[model samples]
Target: MTFISLRNVTTLYSLENVSLDIAEGELIVLLGFTGAGKSTLLNVVAGLTEYQGEVYFNQQNMNGIPTERRDVGYLLQDIYLFPHLNTFDNIAFGLRANSCPADEITEKVEAILALLHIGHLKKRYPKDLSGGEKQRVGLARSLVMEPKILLLDEPLASLDPATARNIRKEFKALHNRLNLTTLYVTHDFTEARELADRIVVIINGELKQSGSAQDIFCQPAPEIQEFIAAAN
Candidate 1:
């Protein structure tokens, strides 16, 4: 049931001795303060950065695999929609790059737009859409690829409070509907508590603790307890 596994994974500078397993269809949130190697860990899983140790996706070693071939859907904190492409083309970009047939690309794009409830925004350009709409379109672009694992790096970080809350609900709903195995990275404890089936805490390049939300909230490590106190 382990869809993604990292064994003693270390990045060049940020991450060290990190190991974890994410189950199939499970949603885990990586919780940490800024510069705590959360993004570096995600980059390692997505094959966007070089790391020492083992990374496995669906039981296959992923050492030398390229990012695109790793079958991962990665959404970074910064939305990187192509300014030249409208919403539909932006979502269809990956399919087109993979040389999917024209009809198939259209079908997939339409389906994702509907699934994300952005069907009406298809004709709008990035400049014309609101922040939430743009974020959803970026999500549609990543989800349309049908990746084995979805890596979301603070996808809600930029939204207003109400919009972020609404999008969080939508993300949970989509995950259930699609049975997505997702690794969501965030620094917000409330967001982590709301979205994670399990929570992994990292600090200064090492994993401190990981457990269910109740366990983490009730019996966190000293460092995590300190963090919680400081945040409050």
Candidate 2:
């Protein structure tokens, strides 16, 4: 089933005439360089940006749905954990805002912490955590919300290579275990190659190509041919 669909999604600023469909439990990677409208497309689905198009979730038009009501868990490259909050509180912030009961909040937070392997760091503050740890905490914060869709924008771009690789494995595992429909944006070819169920290439705010890894690599557009060669 198509879990998310965007039709002629032209953003007010960058993206133009874009359309994509993400199946339930599928992970789609938006592969593009900076200023390529990858993030703008993400913001469009997140309902954070104005666009002239139709965005649908489970066949229901999300035209005027507010961001909070969209049931989307968004994690950006910049992990902003509140300075005053510890790991537990940071992840619990959203639930707290929704006025969830204290006991239920603890249960949900702890489960996500364990799933992300950040259980031990729950008591520690953001300032004391490493880069990878902070990213995991931020991921935990998003996952703890139990969203139906997950949108990640270069979530591990700031990490060291070794750490990024390890977290990439964790991301794959989480996606499989949770089975959430995910749209991830990144410029890292390796990340897209390893993680995407399907890779969609965007250039200058337009979707240039989309297909399986082999399909894309076998018959890439001119720009993407250069991109693949440059990555290699």
Candidate 3:
């Protein structure tokens, strides 16, 4: 069943109709260049930005829901690890904010560190860790909350190619293993092809085309065709 549904959705800054229904357990990628409104799309879903139209997730209508109450986790391209806190505390920040039990926080944070194979870095601070390690902690922090949906806005955009590819691999593996309903925004064609069950194209503040990755790659519309050619 569809986990997140956007119907005839329109935002103030955008001119075209925006609609999408993301299925449960699907990793959907919104592929577009900068200024394509990809970031705005994700912000709207995460309830950080206002928009006009219907949006529902996990059966909850999101028309007027506030960002904090939306239960949507967003991992931005800029990784915001706390400089003062160690990896464990950074990952525990969300749970603590939600007033989770002390014992539970300890258990959850430890499990995440182990799960992401970052157990050894639990005591390390953000300044001490590598770019990839920092990202892993950021991801672990988000996933531990078990939000209804995860929105990633060019999460790997700032990384070196090798680091980005490596992180994306871990993301895909974890996403599939957990069957998490996720929305990923990227301009990287390889990232789109590797991580998405379906791909949505956006251009000039509008959604242009959307379909299975294979459908999009094999049968491209004019705009998409031109864009792909240029990207290549």
Candidate 4:
């Protein structure tokens, strides 16, 4: 069933009238170059920006819902961890903000750390961690919240090729295990092909096409063909 819907969504400057529907437990990848408004679209669903249109989650209108109430786990490209906080504290920040019991926070944080294989890094600060370690820690912070929806904005963009590939595999595995309804934004065709249940192509804020990987590659729209050609 449709779990998330955007109808005639438009931003003040970046996004245009765009509509898309995402099903429960589906991973829809938004593929586009930088400044394509992919991130803005994510912020719209996240309720972090103003827009003109309708956004619904699980059949409920999300127009006026606050960001925290939306139950969204947003992982951005930067993945900045607090300089003074250890991995454990950084991951536990959200739980603490919600006034969760200390023991419960510890339990959740530890579980997430183990899930992300960052348990060993819990005592280390962000300054001591490598790129991949930081990324895992950042991911742990989001997954620990157990949000109903996960929004990723070029999460692996800053990593090296090998690290990006590894993290990509982990993301796919996590999605399958958690059955998360995820909207992943990326410019990488390979990443979209590997992870997306469906791929939606956005160009200059407009959705040009959307379909399975095979459909997109076999009978691409003119815009998609051009994008692919440009990539090649």
Candidate 5:
């Protein structure tokens, strides 16, 4: 059931001895304060950050895999939609880049739009759409590529409170529906509670504790307790 595994992973900027395993189809939330190496850990998984340990995807070595070859999808806080492309074009951008067949690209784009419940907004540009809509478009674009693992780095951080909550709900629903293994990075405990099957708390660049929601929330270790207290 294990789909992703990191062993003795160490990142730059003073993060040392970081690691964890993510189950197949599981949603893992990286919980930590800012600059806790949450984003660096995600990039390590995505092959976007350099690390000294081994990363495995589907039990295969990911040591030499480039970001493109790793088949990991990353969703950032900004969504980063192309300025010139409309919603549909942005969604299909990856497909076009990867040289997916034209008919297949259209079908995939349409399916993702419908799956995300934004089929009607495909014609709109990011400028015209609301924050929630733009985020969905970013997600669908990543999902369309059918990456082996999806990585989210505080995808909900920049939204207004109400929008962030609603979008996280939609994201959790989508995660369940698609059943894709996702590594979600966030500082919000509430969002982590809603999305993660496993909670991994990292502080000062090291893993403090990791387990199910009940275990992490109800019986937090001292480091986790300190983190929660500090956050509140």
Candidate 6:
């Protein structure tokens, strides 16, 4: 089934007319240059920004829905874990805000912690955790909400190369294990190549091309050819 659909969606100033459909459990990557509206597209679907057209989740129109009610999880480049909250509390903040039962919150939080292999850092504050550890916690916090769609905007960008590569593998495994429908945005071609099941390339606020990684690399558009030439 088409899990998320955007029909002629355009974010104010940032994203031009864009339409895309993502199927359930597909890990699609948005690959573009630094200012190509990749993040803008994700924000539109998350309802964090206003757009001109329609966004549908499970065939339901989401024009008037708010971000918190969208059943989407977003993890940005910066780890915004509250400085004062311990790991467990930070992960549970959303559930608490929604008045989920304390016992249910505990169950969900614990399950996510274990799933992300961050159970050992449950008591550590964000200040005490390393960069990679903090990112893992941020991911755990997002997954704890049991979101149907996960939107990640360069979640591994700040890590060292080795750490980033390892996390990419972990993220791929997690997506498969959880059957997550994910839209991951990144400017790095290597990262997109490594993680994407299908890649969509956006340039100058336009979707230039989209296909399997092999197809995209092997038979790129003229613009994409230029991009690859410049990158190499």
Best by lDDT: 4
Error of 2 at 124 (Å): 1.4
What lDDT is reached at residue 60 by model 6?
A: 96
- Candidate 6 lDDT (Cα, 0 to 1): 0.91
**Candidate 4 wrongly placed segments (more than 4 Å):** none
> Could you give me the TM-score of model 6 versus the true structure?
0.97
- Per-residue error for 170 in candidate 4, Å, reads 1.2
**What TM-score, to 2 decimals, does candidate 2 have?**
0.97
Candidates 3 and 6, the one with greater TM-score:
6
Model 1 ranges off by over 4 Å: none
lDDT of 6 by residue, 33-84 (tens): 7878999998998998888999999999999999989999999879699999
Instruction: Give TM per candidate.
Output: 0.98, 0.97, 0.96, 0.98, 0.96, 0.97
- Give Cα-based local distance difference scores for all models: 0.92, 0.93, 0.88, 0.93, 0.89, 0.91
- Summed over model 4, clashes come to 0
- Candidate 3 ranges beyond 4 A from true positions: none
Model 1: per-residue lDDT, tens digit, 78-129?
A: 8888999999999999999999999999999999998889999999999999
**lDDT string, candidate 2, 62-122, tens digits:** 9999999999999977988898999999999999999999999999998888888889998
Question: Candidate 4, residues 108-180: lDDT per residue as tens digits?
Answer: 9999988888899999999999998988998898989999999998999888999999999998999999999
Clashes, model 1 = 0
| Cα displacement (Å) at residue 47, model 6 | 0.5
Candidate 4 is scored at a TM of 0.98
What does candidate 5's lDDT look like per residue over 62-129, in tens digits?
Answer: 99799988888898768899978999999999999999999999999999999889999999988998
**Candidate 3 residues 157-229, lDDT tens each?**
8789999998889899899888888999999999999999999998877778899889888998889998888
> Against the true structure, what is every candidate's RMSD?
0.8, 1.1, 1.3, 0.8, 1.2, 1.0
Model 1, residue 114: displacement in angstroms? Answer: 0.8
Q: After superposition, how far is residue 49 of candidate 5 from its true place, in Å?
A: 1.5
